[model samples]
Target: MNRCLSTLAKLDEEGYSAPALARLADRRAFPPRLEFTRADIMEIRTRTAAHMSISGVQEKISLRLHRGKLQPVTEDGEYILKPIPGLALPRFQEDVPANENLTMQLAEQIYGIHTAPNACIRLANSELAYITRRFDRRRDGTRVAQEDFCQLMGKTPESAGPLYKYGASYEELGQALRKYCSAYPVELEKLFRQIVFNYAVANGDAHLKNFSLQQTATFGDYVLTPAYDLLCTKLHLPEESRLAIDLFAEDEEPESIATYGFVTGADLLDLASRFGLIEQRARTILNDICDHRDKARDLIARSFLSDEAKVVYQAIFDERLRALEIRG
Candidate 1:
């Protein structure tokens, strides 16, 4: 077995120890983790393609996984398999587990309100393992037309400057959002709930790359995919930041979407109203979120995160709820 893989196995067998992992991380420039060999990468690609019929996988987005030679199984007609990076080990670093756990918790909370792709497995070879369901696949080997918010704004990840640049006022984007909601009323309502949930959880990283539109032949139109990559970064990052392109105009904050372009309470209500949700239903949803604070906290603790990470996670939840003035 590879040294990194062996170490990871030992760590997993013994259970996660934050102090030990921290020390190990300090000792090496790179995290003491395994890397998938070319053979492993090919095998994964072949297997995924065989099972799902994904034909091409690109090394876009983050280079970490691509470096491991693991391509996204785009040919898979049903799901996408995100191979774990060899160098990315599973440790309590930056509260990643907490983030993932939070995704699952939020999924359950908004059960009918939001739709997220399933997280099938958490693989651990030498480093962190993430196996998420592919939302861009169909039953047959066909490609789904999709566009990230960034692409719509003519920006790549590297070119993405300030969130405010791709402000919500872009007439095209506004029209797209309006059209998507008009056609998919049910899905749009769920998405609106997800936006509110992100704010309540203090997910300051909800930027354009995080949102996307899926085009399908059945509807012969484009619509937003179920929510994915939901992590509360407010607790992990500095203060007074958000992951929205606009503020207040859409939800509840007094700021204009063009000004302080973070998703706020004002944005949520605005979206709800657009989706035909009355004040009473919208308020009820907000109240339900406030009531689930304790639940979110408990779920954080239960996730595969260190105790300290849990505390940090919970604190963010508390702070965000208070900031939103959400009452249980």
Candidate 2:
């Protein structure tokens, strides 16, 4: 009857389209509401802190598709459930789940960026939680080899200090991909588009851990994993930095940043040159994203975010567009 998180399709009261159901389950059955509330998740997180391998600020738990319903699990979870953050979190905290769902959808459906399959589902308390199927696990339960840029660069909190993940610029990520991925040329474009998309959507948390390389079907060859942990951080932390990390290292930074105190489209094109993309290819990609404003706005309208949150999200996007010089 309305847009569901799975496909944003309007077909069934179950809030899932036929295709979404097929992708999420073999029986095409709608998953029952979660059995636990947000408070329950916080309790479980505290109790299981020592044993849990997954780490993040938000309270989350592993889940599995069991007997046509989603079930919480301690291990071998196929999906990750992120409820609204705790009370001590930033502003507009309750909108986090819906914001993530809509942003991920915009990345995949509108900008053609590869992303983890995600949706917002209601909890037992009727509050929404963001659910994402893990990309690191295969259907038969075999684990794929994956490494975030932090590991790939051999940096740790102890060795590189607490802010290690935010220490490097996005240029270093491209360098890592060039060094590790045999298919460097193709993956470079994907990385570039991802960065541009992040800026467009106000996803300020595109840090080293968020961008990773995964082992492909061919052994020893790794490529950029589908995007994950994407959301409009500006909505929750309005005064934070525009991006998690800088676009270039100090020496390679475009003159525009020093002159204007911000990044410009010309600076991005320069960065593309550093990544081995010719001017034509870079301009084409930039133009393509700029052209998607209408579609992105439409998805935001269809999103489950409250009216006030939607307005804030659109205004942030518009500001980013101007900053990047994509809009006149």
lDDT of each: 0.50, 0.83
Model 1 lDDT per residue over 1-328, tens place: 1112111222433332443233222222322232453346546555544444332232111112233232343333232334322333234443553355455446554333444433322333433332333566553546678877666667753665454334453223444566654465554555556666777767766666677888867866777876776766555554646544443334344443454443445555655665566677777776677767655665565554457767777777776666555221
Number of the top TM-score candidate: 2
205-254 per-residue lDDT for model 2 (tens digits): 99999999999876668999999999999999988887789888874665
The top-ranked prediction according to lDDT is 2
Q: What TM-score quantifies how close candidate 1 is to the native fold?
A: 0.61
Cα deviation of 129, candidate 1, in Å: 2.5
Model 2 shows how many backbone clashes? 0
TM-score of each: 0.61, 0.95
